[model samples]
Target chain A: MSDELYFKPLTELAALLDTKKISSVELTRSVIARTKAVDARVRAFNSYDEADALAQADESDRRRAAGKARGPLDGIPVGFKDVIAVAGQPLTASSKMLANFVSPYDATVTQKLKHAGAVVWGRLNLDEFAMGSSTENSAFRATCNPWDLARVPGGSSGGSAASLAAGEAIATLGSDTGGSIRQPAALCGVVGLKPTYGLVSRYGLIAFASSLDQIGPFTRTVEDAAVMLGGIAGHDPLDSTSYETKIPDYRGELKKRKGPWRLGIPKEYFGEGLDPEVGAAVENAIAFYRERGCEIKEVSLPHTDYGVGVYYIIATAECSSNLARYDGIRYGHRSKEARDIIDLYFKSRAEGFGAEVKRRIILGTYVLSSGYYDAFYLRAQKVRTLIRQDFLNAYREVDAILTPTSPTPAFKQGEKSDPLAMYLCDVYTIGVNLAGLPGISVPCGFSSGGLPIGLQLIGQPFQEAELLAIAHAYEQGHDWGERHPKL
Target chain B: MSAPADLNIDHVANLARIALTPEEKAKFARQLGEVLHHIEQLRKVDVTGVEPTAHAFPVYNVWGEDVARPGLAVEAALQNAPAQRDNMIVVPKVVE
Candidate 1:
């Protein structure tokens, strides 16, 4: 019972816990044991404290016993991407800079999850400072795809998606800048959702790209994703960018908002680069929707070709500004060889950052510099407007847009050595982030090689409820998500 | 707009306050040059009257009421600092 308990979905575990069939401690221990057993091969965690997790689980069981159960999430163990702050826990961001730094306070999402009675589990690894498409950029170690250990787990949220797929965590939290959550989720065969920008607070998330970054969930099922979203989504004064709106019961809305809705297929997404198997899987998903009486239209988003180009400029510029805080003075890594204050800044950053990080910083700095600012940065922003306008214009005709979450299934580790080649991995998913709309990646099918493929649904800003329902309509009928990798 | 020549790595790295090795400098210049060349296509977009969007959803002048809130304890705040003395971060001397 304990052995198989690790792979059970959050909703199922919740019911068992409520019926007193299983205690939180028992479930947490099973997950811990599973993690300890499989983590050597998968390498999903940055750090986990078994005693701390069990203590939280014990407290949760005590609450439920005392007739004060918080909610469905109570006693559920959930892992967090290392970028999200967990008070007194190591917050490494998979970077050597913060390798020893501990978070001083809880991120808003962390506080909210704790309030929902979640047993915060462990710090999951990621690409260093959430910069790369593959977790190979991690200063610590690379996370392997559980399905095929030789393949890469699509990243910067590779650990979040891999752990959930490996059944080491029931549900996990991850941050998405450009397809980080969705791509990894697609590769790992799980449900990953990126809520509309500003819908979820970004208060304590280690900044990657301020305008593009969002915190979201990776769950085995759409229903679990909805539950996790409800626990973490809300406005907070702590994040001024956090939007204020009615927090609807997302799970309840799943049953209430049934849709035989109009879905658009952006032709640009299905073009040349998409793998044939992944493309066929998405086409079948569209056919499923059409057969169910939902209208499927081919909508053209003309500016789609420029998404990656525009994203690199805007995201890098924002990251450069946000990352300047790590100057080796107040906190984080400080170099011991510095002779002066200025030299300290230079030497520390040089020593602390990885190759990918330094390359981005230089690129970001060049784009934002005086002479090139208008030519590069400002022009990119203008093109960004056109890219966003393309999406808003498409929404005028359709309820949501459908596409493959990733172009191909998970590629082999270290397959994409060139920087430009790695950047192209996000072609299908970057547009959603550029437009700041809600998007979700649900398991559509598997590649012939037995690797998973994801179908992405893009919805209007603040329309995550409708988006989840659309994805759920197909997910409910399919058994693709039911299959697990043999570890 | 014409694409610029290879990036001046030393100048940009200095601006970013990072000291890169000679190998990194050469490699990054070539890589970033290709990326920049691709970005030059953005110049073709006609922006006659288009406004640049710094944020996807722009909010302006967010006002918060003057209220006292508990802050991180000094110990907690300084826990990760590399060097500290008497509740203050210790940095290299700016003055002789």
Candidate 2:
């Protein structure tokens, strides 16, 4: 019975809790026991507190019993990727640099989640500082894909994806810099939404590439993600980059969405490195949409090839400046054997950061350095403008853009030991980040060898409501979202 | 711009404030070169007269009401500091 409770979708679980069929405490305990049991192989969370989770669950139960429940998520268990700040909880970003550091206050997302009465769980592991495409860059441990324990769960939000798929949490939140959220969601066979950059506040999310970093959700279905996205997204005076826009009822929009949606499949996405099996699966999705009377148009996003190049330059340059804050002054680790200030700064950073982080910092520092800044950083940004224009131009012809979320399904743990090959893993999804638009990865089908593949649908900025509706329409047409990785 | 082969890992490491060993330096020089080569594809496109896009979403100067509010307490602020003395973070001395 406890094992059976692990895999129910959030909507079903909520209905059960709402009707008093099962108390929140009972559900929370089941999730906790399952997390402990499967965590030995999965390693999804870096740290979680059973006492705190159970206490919150009991409080939720008491509120429900008294007819004072706050909202749809009142008793729901939600996991957070480690980088998000939760006051008094550790905020490591899975890096040794902040291995012992605790946040002084809540990030905007955490505050919103708590406000919605979610039983906020614990720190899910991520790529150190949310840099890598795979969570192996985490200093602690890599989160294993639930579909196959030998493979990665995709990253930098690998743990978030794994936990939801493994039923450790009903839903989870993750930050996408490049394809961090969507790519992982695809590999883990779950729903992941990357909202438009400013639509969600970034006040408490640890900066990866400030310009590209946006926090989003990972869930079992499109509707839960829609519900949660509404919960967390809003205007905040704290995050300067956050958009000042009226929040939309995304779940409601999903309910009222009608027929005749337009979806464009970019020719550039289906070429070269794409695995044939993943291609065939997405083709089926296109046919399904066509059968539902939606127009399937072939569109051109001209600058798609240059997206990875432009993104690496811009993301790294911003991160170099953002990460310079952890220089052993106010908080975080300081070198033990420093002779003076110079030695302290150098040694502390050198000792603290992992190899991947240092590599990015070095690349970023070089690009932003005096002589080369215009040639590398400036050129990249100009190219970014072109990439954004490509999406903007394409949107003139289509309501949504559809493509494979990843070139292929999740590969074995160390298959991509070479960094360059791993970076290419995000080929199909990075352009959306450059344009700062909303995109989602919903489980469309699975690859041979039984790994899941994702279908990415991108929408105009601030049109997450419409985007979620499109995803929900396709999701309800098939049984893909209902399938879970058997642990 | 210089060729991708001349990315200069040591100089970059110095600028980044990290000290890389000879092995790491050699590995980065090779790896970063490959990444730079991948990025070099952008040179084919003409960005002449095009303004650089620093952010996907445009932002005007953001403002907040000029009112003071409660912030993180001194205790909480200093709680995560690796070395704190009397509510102040301690660092290596810079001035003589």
Candidate 3:
């Protein structure tokens, strides 16, 4: 019973803990054991402290014994992407620059989870600075897709997705800048949600693209995703961009907002580079909605083609600005050989950053540079306005937009060595970030070759309740998420 | 407008404060040229009166109270610094 406890959903585990059927220690130990057993192969965690996790579990057990159980997340083991700061823990972001850096303070989400009695588990791996689609850009190790070990786990939040799917954690938190959470969740056969921008605080998250980055959850089921989202969704004064809107009871709203929603199928999502197997899976999902009395319509987002182009410019520009804090004089790696102050900055950055980080920084710097600012950076920003309008126009007719989470299922490691080819992996998902809408990827079906495919539901801004209900509606009829990877 | 192929890698890398090797400069020049060529499609979009969106949800004039709050302790603040002395981050000489 303890061996399989890690695979249980948060709701089920919460019930057990409430009934005193299982101790939080028992549940946490099971998850820690599972991680130790399989993380050698999955390469999901950057670092974990078993003693610290057990200590937190003990504290949670004490709370429950005192009839002070905080909530559903109480005593639950939840992993965090290394990009989110967990005080006193190594927050590497899977980058060598901060390989030895420990977070000084907890991220707002981390504080909230702890307040809810969650056992803060481990620091999960990700693409260095959350820059790449595939976890291959991680300076550490590439996280393998659990379904097929040779294949890549779609990433920047690759470890967050893979860990949940592999039963290493009951649920995990991941930051999605573009498709980091949803794409990896799709690949790893888990439920991943990117909340509406500014819904979750970004105070302690290692900045990538400030305008686009959002922290969300990865869980085995849509219901679990809701529970996790509720645990972390609220405004923080620490993050100025965090909106001061009332965070609804997302899990409760799932049952209340039973929607025969008007779902829009964006035609651009099904074209050209989409893999047929992935396409069939999404089409089947659309058909599922149609049969269930939900109105499905064909919608055109004309600026969809320009999403990738606009995103590359905007995300990179923001990143180049955000990442400038990593000078050698402060925390993180410093160059051993430097003659002057300027030389130190150049040598430190060159030596500390990975290839992809360097490439993006250069591109970002170039686009935001003196002569090209109007043509590249400013032009991309204007186009961003158009891309956002495309979504708002569609929402006037439909409650949510349905699309594939990723154009293709998880590709083999090193399959896409070209940076351009790699950037295209995010084409289907970038538009949501550009528009600041809530999006979720629920496992729709599996490919013939056994890769999992995800169906994405893009909801109106701050309407995660409706989106999760719609996702939960489809997820109820399917067993795609229940069937775990045979690791 | 300058062509995408006209990206000067040396100039950009210098601005970014990243020292690139001769090999990296050449490789990046060719690769970024391709990416820039792809991004050139944005030029075709008519943006006569469009407003640039810096953030998806623009929250303006977010003023917090002027009360002082406790921040990281001195010891905690310098925990990750590569070089430090008396809680101050050590840096190379700036004065000539």
Candidate 4:
């Protein structure tokens, strides 16, 4: 009923729904309207389904009125990154290879959200096969940053982060491989979580890098992130890698959160490449936490320097294998008039994959090939073990680690044309994924250029509840979340 | 590291099943060298006697229950393929 519905926190929305101050249908309608108003300029969503969203919201309203409670995400309108399957809907990954592809069943994450009574608002855009750091690699139109359309929203989950930043959707699901979730979240000035590997099921989500990919939520606030995470964070029989640990009440603990928490600052994070403005903002965040009675200790993660190299090998190798199924067989994208099966394979992939994707796939296949595996892929995996050990040792002495999420603020679109240049932007983030630890990017401050800077918090595997509590406390202590883009 | 020209762009292209123009091969050779050089930084670290782990954490095997589950129908499976013939996807002859 109020304009505040788009800006209200998820917990507040849930409370209003519980007290019937705003009907589920009304909330869904309002969000749908906001999305229509803003998305034309933002290009955040690849597919918008107002009829389905309203129908689901009506169902949620009926359930609530009948006193049949589902979960915390009840009546919330959330968006799905296009790569994720949404049952009987398209799952294109924004690639021509899957242009007409429709999923037969919901992905595991989608099933969980639906079970929690959340309305599936629409499908947000993403880079093709989640390949690039910027959504510019998308075979579809690029997703613009809400703050400044000329600058990029960090990518491949660019649209997911942009949608949340523009208030088009209260929350959206994003898949992080490398820094897909964190980078975009930082660029768009939103809260994005990259849950520890296997913490959430990847069964229904399209594979980017099987080992590196983890689906998480992007929201405007820390509390909203916790609430949305609660709905989708548990074991699923269909996804073998799903967590077996108990799903804690993240929202509840965050509400009563008090901190004397130990925050680790890895010396490796504040190194040569970090921009001055970004570095100052992170230091300020650490000082803010120190004032909140949280202990700050400088820690070492020696293998941090090798994180990008190791992750690239492991991720690309897995991508080569995972994407092998798309060789003009089974489903999606087949080349016509091929001389034979092999030519069909060649032509299909040649026509299907974009430049960045081709580069990774080639590198991956080369590393995993016979005679090269021991030298490249095997060596990278060995280093990956060392990277994980670095985190294990650091966590023994700290509750969570804080660092700058990216080396620099959002660069102008096309500034990083060289693939390696783009890859370096993930230097701060790759280490966490290689260690299989949970990480979140929270807006810390704005650069002198008015672009946002993000501070990352890395937690041990399955420790999202503690992570959220710390982030919630930090959000309250600082006025960062109060800031919004001038779009 | 191999010379930029000696990087076997053709061999890599064959393995990746991508057709590349000569210009593309030359261009990618330089790009791949740059990336490989960046990757060579990992070689500086001492990883002697360390056990290799493909997964970040230890897990014997992560798998779902082996049960027959409903899948998309045959028609649905081939719906998106650009070229299909006789209820099967048509591709170039695989055997040389």
Candidate 5:
């Protein structure tokens, strides 16, 4: 095993493939072999088809050799979170409900990746139906943190982050509803971006909390994430929610931009529960930026304290509506002994969904149900507005806000068994999604436990380019990216 | 404030649809109470006259020209159904 290639950044991999120094087929073969080496212990993937991956890699090599290179990600291997569909591939979303479900067509994002000449390495694990903060709730299996096998890789994008951190793939795509993508990236010591809500098409992604979900990339560096956003961000006719907004050259912004950025720090974020080491890491990161001629100021997101309450209400409501299609009638799972059509609906749903998923669905159904709509769902929707306004007002005063990505660094696996305890892992992140803004989690420093800590940077809507540039500059300024967990 | 334990769990479970065993029902009631207590904190803030916002920004309402495009073929849509028999999706009969 070449240690040099194991955690190499995506750009380096692309260069190696382009110059004929290393062929895409060779890299694909190496990754498959690496996955085989670590899979039993890591449990990051639910499925992998080696022949198809190699075939795509061969296609990439042919295009590069002919000087008809597809795009920046021309020969890299990338994993798709199971919720996204790839034509002719099964997209189980790690649930029994969709266990045998094969997508008849490619998701708009999958089509874009293929057009850019990337190989679909495999489908990574996720929470059943993309619920839950820890992948422990996954019906398939929990994804272990690469840093310490006993600790969880934060989820619902847990497998996507673990794969990138463990060198199973160079980059992987993940969808964020609440903190799915960023939380896992923070826990895994990798970079992940959640593009502004409408920036990417959601045409074929298995629906979760629709209003909040956005697809983004988890990669080793800010620049690789930018390259991926370039490919996957675009409007699609099939998804009405996709933004008609222009796609900027996110990588180019890294060069053309300079910052004396006003960075906002919310006092609410540094409340009692934050770990001492995690607090120090964030302060040190802020100090580093201040030394680089940035302004650090205290800003109040007064509504910040209410983020979780509003998030659960809104997220669950959207999920309940989106999940209505899975009644055992149209697709996937069917109850073997249903006595009638209605019994089939009830039994299939009862048996198909896992505990956490059912909890959210029921909560969602309750809130949206006729009697409680005015008091619970309606009030949460109003609070959601106030939350968005708070960010909008804060952005007016600051170029971007800086905060600890998680309250504490990654915890021991199964440490947070109570579901509410698990949900708190997303407190710092969910507000950004609520605001429909772009946010990135970058490796900042290490906790006392020797696990990595991440600092989140959030910018105004459509400001991904500016946000990525600052993240890139910070990565260049620090030594955090050099440290990797020993596999 | 504690009511009959059975009543509280029954109300939530009947609404939620899990066939919780008696012990599981009791456990869930306790956990659910704790979670609801945390959420109850939001009620302390004054939100008078605040309009509820569903989307972050003001998006233009998109109404399309009234034109029909290709719809999915019936066979294509039903091809993945686990219990489809005939043109309709087949399932077990339900008793009223």
Candidate 6:
């Protein structure tokens, strides 16, 4: 009974909660208790208020009992990445810079979740300022992969995935900037989706790279991810970047598996650094699709090699500008020893920012510097257009592109100390973001070490529903979605 | 790769307004040089006449009704301030 309740998909839990078969408080407690038991090793949550969670859960129960349950997420518990604001709650973004800072307002997504009747809980760990590939860069603590305690859970969204892998949360919200959501979701063996850029509001998500950053969901199934996306997606007047498009029923197409859909296999993704086991598993998935009357074709995204270089230059350039707000005056840490304004700016930032963040900031400042702007940042932006055009060109030939989410399965924590090595982990997933295309990472198989490997599907802009359907077709054909980590 | 002599790490740090210790300066200089070396690969692509995409989706003049709306209270806004005086965020004196 405990196992059944703890790992139940968000959709299943929603149904159970609606029917009163299990109360929200019970479900919330079970997840909280499970987190306490396993998070010592998984290190998923940075902070969780049990009393606050219970109160929300208890309130949800009363509302449901009165037949006044809110929306689909009513009575469900969802965790938030530390970057997303929750009113009066810690919004650390996993850095010492904002270690003691609390949000003054609820983020649009948070407000949406509350309106949906979901009990918001937990400040999930992330790379400090959402800047690194591994949660190892978090100033607070590194989150561990539930599949293998020694391996990283992938990152930026590492804690979101780790929490789900260990059954700590029913579902989670993670932000993707240069594959922060999809890469971690792939590494940790859960279903995660990054909607087409601007589909979800970014009003209160602490900016890392404004252009590339987008908020999405992590769940155990494509259906749950679709449901989570539906609850949070739509135009928000507060976020000027939020897409002004009709929000469709994201789960409507999950049930439509009518065949003969075209899937593009990018030759670039299967190249060097791909582990043989992971390649074979995605290959198997492709074959499974082919036998079901689907057409699989080889497509070229020729500018793929430039994705990483272009992404770093562009992402960091924007990051340096966005992060300038943390000047230690209005909010966050201040240097106690500074004798003047200039001294304070230098000391507080040096003391507060992490090494990875500092490295990116310096690089960003250099790229945008007077002599180098045309040579680096401008050049990268031009290349970024080519990279984006490559996707636009590919989608004309096929309905979607399929690739291995990461080059390999999860690696050991601290295995990659080279910053470039860490950046390369997002190679397969970054270009999709550059093009503003929607993409998802769902478990395809496991490696010899029992770590999960993910297969990604990229869809055309504003077609997340169709994207979810294709993922659902593959997910329902296999038991990958059902396999939970043996915590 | 050896560090580039053209760019001084301290100058860049000054541009970023973050003062690093001597040890941090040396370490950042070396590491930033390595990453810049990696990023130099972008120069190989011929992007002549390619329009730079600052955003994937272009939405313009996203105006809203300009009216006074209730915002965070003074106390709430100042909740995270490092120092506050007279219910205002206190900072170093900008003028004599």
Best by DockQ: 3
Which ranking of candidates, highest DockQ first?
A: 3, 6, 1, 2, 4, 5
TM-score of 6: 0.98
> Which of the predicted structures, 2 or 4, would earn the higher TM-score when compared with the native?
2
Given candidate 4, what's the lDDT at residue A142? Answer: 87
What's each prediction's clash count?
0, 0, 0, 8, 6, 0
Candidate 4: C-alpha RMSD to true structure equals 2.2
Candidate 2 docking DockQ: 0.82
The digit string of per-residue lDDT tens for model 3 on A142-221 reads: 99888999998899999999999899999999999999999999999999999999999998999999999999999988
Model 2 chain A worst lDDT run, 10 consecutive residues: A1-10
Provide the TM-score, chain A, model 5: 0.98
TM-score, chain B, predicted structure 1? 0.89
Model 2, TM vs. native: 0.98
Show where candidate 1 strays beyond 4 Å.
Answer: A1-3, B1-6
TM-score of chain B of each: 0.89, 0.88, 0.91, 0.74, 0.68, 0.90
The weakest ten consecutive residues by lDDT in model 3 chain A span: A1-10
DockQ of each: 0.82, 0.82, 0.87, 0.58, 0.47, 0.83
For model 3 chain B, give the 10-residue run with minimal summed lDDT: B1-10
Cα lDDT for residue A104, model 6? 89
Question: What's model 1's lDDT at A272?
Answer: 88
- Candidate 6: regions farther than 4 A off: none
Q: Residue A316 deviation, candidate 1, in Å?
A: 0.5
> C-alpha displacement of B91 in model 3, angstroms?
1.1
lDDT of 4 at B82: 63
Candidate 1 residues A1-487, lDDT tens each?
Answer: 1248888778889999999999999999999999999999999999999999999999999999999999999999999999999999999999999999999999999999999999999999999999988798999999999999999898999999999999899999999999999999999999999999999999999999999999999998898999999999998888888898888899999998788999999998988898999999999999999999999999999999899999999989988898899999988899999999999999999999999988888889899998988888898889889989999999999999999999999999989998888999999889889889999999999999999999999999998899989999999889888788899
Better of 2 and 4 by DockQ: 2
Residue pairs of candidate 4 with colliding backbone atoms: A340-B91, A340-B92, A340-B93, A341-B91, A341-B92, A341-B93, A342-B92, A344-B92
